[model samples]
Target: MIVGIIGGGQLAQMLAMAGQPLGIRCLFLDPAPDACARTAGELLCGDYGDARLLDELARRATVVTYEFENVPEASLRRLASRVRVHPHPGALALARDRWHEKRLFADLGLSTPPFVAVDTRADLDRALAVTGWPAVLKTRTMGYDGKGQRVLRTPGDVDAAFAALSGTPLILEGFVAFDREVSLVAVRSADGDARFYPLTENVHRNGVLVQSRARPGDPMASRAEGYVGRLLAHLDYVGVLAVEFFQKGDMLLANEMAPRVHNSGHWTLEGAETSQFENHMRAVLGLPLGATHGLAPSGMVNFVGYLPEASAVLAVPGTHLHVYGKAARPGRKLGHATVRAPREGDVLDALARLRMLADAGGAG
Candidate 1:
């Protein structure tokens, strides 16, 4: 089967790698000539909204999927008319807009941090009146890895934040005093077959993912599954969906959702019986889904901005390094390592060492 993927970034690279063993080939549409996924798949090298490129992708591939959520809606509509797109374009619309995502959560009986939509400076002031101080002012769309957002700690900081992010549609969210952040990575087929991987505990430094560990039987897994299941069913989603949550005691406050394979789910590479990438491909292809159970204690550390020598990373016990063939720069996601071991302590030990390596370069 041939799968056409939009946005040939590292996520597309990983998905292509996963599809290789399954006799699945990937065709990518990306504007950058040196898009990192080129090595793993055939890259079309064109703008996302290019009608000719979209037509080429639709003509060649059996199905299509996108890595990033912010793909232009018009492009998806044209492609969907010609070929199938998984997870549905509607899910992407909600994920790209923070306000709609939060409202969906509340409508679905899921908890969310108090938030208000902001279209103007006056709207910001009124939002702050309800959300109060220490709120976050964010552009409603196109924000990722901490970009397009500002944390307003006091009234004095509000004016400057508005000045910085005023040109786009915005959403003002109340600050959440969460205990810890966790994510659920689940897959659902078009036929409604679904599987849930273990909950993942994550750490973010400066809004970029730093590390993630699979918590197979964590007390919160069932609750997270329930919340994500509602979303999967409601959206008629096909393929993988990742929903992040803030755990406050016994509650899980919906943080945000990515309607695609997620960074936090990277541990699944070696941690689960079947990787998220493989399951996503199978789900979209209508193949029977694989088991999502954890095979061992596993964790992953991101190599943001810089990469250490391969020998240094491999020196760590139970570590497997995966580097996207991309030029490194400050705050860029360059690579990652999955730590898997028979014992949870061993996995944790390896992660601590990897964290030190990533931190040394100030990669965050």
Candidate 2:
């Protein structure tokens, strides 16, 4: 089987890695000459919206999947008419814009922080009037890892935010003072079979995911599953879907949803009975969904901005490192390490040991 992937980033690289044992050949469409995923698969170097390139990818792969939501909707729509695209272009379109995403949650009877669309100064003020102070102003499209967003703490910050983020479609969302952030990563096959991973508690630094701990049999697991169920049935979604939530006093408020495999679920590479990347491939191929059971208590710490020494990361007990083979820069995600153990305490200890290795800057 051949799979065509849009956006040749680390996620695509992982997908290609996961597909190899299944006799799945992966190919990628990316404009960047240096896209890291090229090492994993054949690359069709061209603009994302280039029709000639899209036609070539459609002709070559049995199915198409995208690594990120930012792929041009028109391009995908054009390609989908030629070859099958998993998760559907509609789902991709919904995930691309925050306003539509929040509205989908509302339509599905899921809870989300109050939000209002903003397109002008007057719209910003009106949205603020509805959401009040300490609200977040976010671009509706193309924002990730804390980029394209600003928090307005008071009335004083409103004009500046509007000035900075105006001239683009935006969303003003009420801040959720929640207990913690968690995510449920699930895969739904075309046959309607679905499996969900354990809920993961996530910690972020400057809006980038830094750490994630998978807690099996968590109390909030059922609630999170319910929300994801609605999403899967509604989208008739194929492949992995990750929904992030803000937990507050037993309530799970939907924060955002990723249509593809997610960063928080990276621990599943070593911790779960089947890795999410493999399950996603299975789902997209209309194969039976794999078990989502966690094999051990697991934690993943991302290596951002820079990488630690391979020997140091390997020295930590039960720690596995995955380097994306990308150049490091401030706020860039270069790699990650996953630690697993029989007990949660042991996992935490392993995580601590790995963190020390990462912090010490052990030989890069």
Candidate 3:
């Protein structure tokens, strides 16, 4: 089976890696000629709006999915009419806008931070009045990796925050003072068969994921599964869905969700009985879902800006490295390393070793 993927980046690259073992070939449609996923399979370089390219992609592939939600709604709607797209276009559209996404979460009885729309200066004031200071102002569209957002810590920060991100539809989210952040990576099929990976504890720096530790059988795992399951069934969703949460005492507040494979689940690449990438393929292909159990206690460290020496990273016991074939950029995610061990302590030891190497500027 040939699967068509929109956006040719690391996620697509990993998808292709997982699909190849199942005799599934991937073709990517991305505007960037040098997209790293090009090495995974055939690449068709064109803008998302190009009708000719979209027609050709739909014509060639049996199924289609996008690596990211930022793909234009019009493009997805056009393709949905021509080919099968997992998770549905309507789900994609809702996930693309923060306001709609939050409302959906609230409607489903999932806890989310208080939020209000901000379009004009007065709207900002009104939102602040409701959400109060120290809230987060985020653009409704095209924001990722911590970009397109401002943290308003005081009344004095409002005008500056608005000036910095002027003219974009925004959402002001009340600050969440949670103990920690965790996420659930779940997959559902057309048959309504579903399973979830172990909940993962994530640590972020400047809005970018720096590390994630898989907490299999954590007390909060069941709670997260319940919330994510509600979303999957509600969307009649197919393929992998990732939902992030902020935990305070016994409460878990929905942070947001990703419609495709997520950064937090990368540990499953080597730690789970079946990697998230493989299960995503299985779900979309209508095959029976794989086991979601972790092979061991696991931790994953993301390589940002640049990667450490591969040899050094591999030297750590139980560590496996995956480097995305891309040039270095200040905030770009270049690769990640996963460590699995018989015990959480061993996993932490391996993680510390890997972090040391990554922090030493890749020096041996």
Candidate 4:
């Protein structure tokens, strides 16, 4: 079967690479001339709203999916009329707006941070009055990797926070003094059979994810599963979705959701019995979902900024490096590396060793 993937980034590239072995042809759509997926598939360079490109893609692919949540709703709606789009556009719409996301979670009785909508200055003021200071002001739409968000540490910071977003739809969220942030990567089949990977403990630097350790042993894993179950049932969602959470005391607070494969789950490529990309494809294709078993205690570290020296990283025992062949730029996610070891060995220790190798300019 042919699978057409929207957004030609490393995720699409990895999806294409994984699909190839399964006798599935992959195609990618993106405007970036040098997008990483271009090297792995037949890339149609065009805007997501370009009807001409969508028409061509529909004619070629048996099914369509997206690599990122930021895909234009119009594009998905247009394509859905011609071909199948997995996980449904409703999920996409929900994921795009933070206020809607929080509401959905609440409606389903899922735990989420205290949040209020902010569309106007008055809304911000009201939200602050209720949620209080030291909150996070985030754009309701088009936010990722810490972009389009500002922290309101004091009352004085509120105006500047609002000014920074320039009156875009917003969500005023109370800060969770959480112990750690975690993500649940789960897949729901067309038949509604859901399988979940071990939860990942994430560490972010400046809002961008830096590393993820698998099976962090948070009691929240079961709670995360419950949240995913309700979310999938609500959307009748088919294919993979990742939900992020903040652990505050014994409670797990919903942070956000990703409708596509997530960066935090990259360790599954080498660490799990079923890689997320493959499971996502299977779920979307109406095939049985694969096991989410972890092969080992693993940690995935993102390679950001300049490309790291690959040789040094490869030299580390149990290290697996994946580099998205992209031009080097400061703060850009060039690729990632996963280090696997026995469950008895310290996962954090492996992560620290990988970090040392990465800091020394080891190849990624």
Candidate 5:
């Protein structure tokens, strides 16, 4: 079967790589002519809203899926009339808006940080009064990797935050003094079978994911798995969905949900018995979900800003590198490296070594 993936970025590139060996052909559509996935599959370069191009894509592929949630809803609706789109557009709608997402989570009996809509200055002030100060103001749509978000520590910061957003509909979320941040990458088949990978402890640098390590001993691990199962059933969701959480004391507060494969699950490519991309493909294709087994205690470190020194990092034992093959730019995620060891502690040590090498300007 041929699958046309929207948004030719690293996620689509990796999905193409995974589908190739499984006898599935992958095609990509993106505005950028030089997108990384363009090198791996048939590339259709054009605006997402170009109906002519979308129709051509639908005719050529057996099914359609997206690598990112920012895909135009109208485009998806138009394509759905022709070809199958997995995880469904309804799921995308919920994932695309923070307010709707919080409501969905709350409806599922899941706990989320207090949040209120900010459509006007009055709404912002009201949200602040209700949720309190030290809140986060985020755009209602197309916000990711720490962009389109600002922290309001005091009342003085509110105007600047709103000014930065420039009147876009927003969500003011109360800040939870969290103990740690973690995410669960789960997949559900079309028939409703669900599976979850090990929870990952994530650390962010300037809003972008910098490192993720498997947290096998987390007390909330079971709760996270249960939450994912409930969410998948609630959305009737099929394909990989990642749920991020803020751990405060004994509570795990829902932070956000991604309808597609996530960066936090990058370790699964080498650390798990089944990679998330493969599982996502299987789920969408009505194939049985693969095992979510951890091969070894693993750590995934993102290579952002510039391409990391791959040759130097490869010289280190048990290090596996995957480069996205994108052009260099400040704060751009160019690639990632996964280090594995017999024990989880050893994986952490390897991450420390990798960080030192990075500090010394050593190449992969």
Candidate 6:
């Protein structure tokens, strides 16, 4: 079986690696001639909007899937007309726009931070009225890794933010002063079979994920699962879905969702009975779903902007490193390492060491 992947980045590369043992070959269509996923599969280099390239991918793949949420909706529709795109095009479209995504979450009975759409300066004022002070202003589309957003606390801040981010549809969400951030990574099949990894507690810097710890028996796990499961069944979703949330006391407020393999679930590669990449392949292929339980106390640290010496990282007991084959640049996701240990304390100690190395490497 051959799977066609859109956007040949690290996620696609990992997916290809996971599928290899299943005798599933992956072919990637990526605009970047140097896309790292090329090392894992055949790469057809071209813009995602190129019709000829889309046709070729459709002609070759058993089924198609994406690695990111920002894949152009028109391109997705074009592919759907010619081939199967799992997790569905509608899911992609909804996940692309913050307003529509929040609406769907609210409609599905998921609590969300108060939000209002911002299109004009007057609309910004109106939205701020609803959301109050210290809210976040984000472009409704194309925002990721903490880009395309501003924290508005005062009139001057709001004015400067609007001046900088205007001309794009925006969303104003009430700032969440929550205890912590966590995400649920779940996968569902076309047959309705589903498996979920333990909830992940995350730490972020500059809107980029820095670390994640798998919480197998988190007190909030069941609530988080209920919310994400509603999304899976509602979208009739197939493949992996990650929903990030802000936790306050016992409440979990929806932040956003990613429709494909996500940064938070990277720990599953070394920590779970079956890696998220493998299970995503199985779900998209309509094969049996794999177990999502942790192999032990697990955690992960991301290598952003730079990566430390591999020997230093591996020296941390229970640490496994994965480096993306790409040049390091400020704010770029270069790689990650997963840590698994017999006890939570060991996992935490290893992660603390790994993060220090990651921070030092990225510092330069």
TM-score of each: 0.99, 0.97, 0.98, 0.97, 0.97, 0.99
lDDT of each: 0.94, 0.91, 0.90, 0.88, 0.89, 0.94
Instruction: Check candidate 5 and list the clashing pairs.
Output: 309-363, 309-364, 310-364, 311-364, 312-364, 313-364
User: What stretches of model 4 exceed 4 Å from their correct place?
Assistant: 344-346, 360-364
Report the lDDT tens digits of candidate 1 across residue range 318-363: 9999999899889999999999999999999999999998878864
What does candidate 2's lDDT look like per residue over 1-364, in tens digits?
9999998989999999999999998999999888999988998999999999999999999999999999987998899999999979999999999999999999999988899999988888899889977899999998999899999998889888888887889999998788999999999999888789999999887899989999899999998999999999999999999999999887889999999999999999999999999999988887787899999899999988879889988888789999999998778888999998888888899888776666565322
Clashes of each: 0, 0, 0, 4, 6, 0
- Report model 5's TM-score to 2 decimal places: 0.97
| Residue 363's lDDT in candidate 5 | 32
Cα distance off (Å), candidate 6, residue 239: 0.5
Instruction: State the local distance difference test value for candidate 5.
Output: 0.89
Residue 303 deviation, candidate 3, in Å?
A: 0.3
**What is the C-alpha lDDT profile of model 3 across 1-364, one tens digit per residue?**
9999999999999999999989999999999999999988989999988889998888998889989999988888888899998878888888899999999999999998899988999998889889876799999988888899999998889889999987889999999878999999999999998899999999888899888999988999988898999999999999999999999999999989999999999999999999999998888878899999999899999888878988889889899999998998877888999999898999999988877766565421
Off by over 4 Å in 1: none
Query: Over the stretch 288-341, how does candidate 5's per-residue lDDT look in tens digits?
Result: 899997888988888877665778788767889998989877788888889888
Q: What lDDT does model 1 reach?
A: 0.94
Residue pairs that clash (backbone atoms under 3 angstroms), model 4: 308-363, 309-362, 309-363, 310-363
lDDT of 6 by residue, 1-364 (tens): 9999999999999999999999999999898999999999999999999999999999999999999888887889899999999989999899999999999999999999999999999999999999998899999999998999999988889889999899989999999999999999999999998778999999999899999999999999999999999999999999999999999988899999999999999999999999999999999999999999999999999999988999999999999999999998988999999999999999999999998999896452
Model 4's alpha-carbon lDDT is 0.88
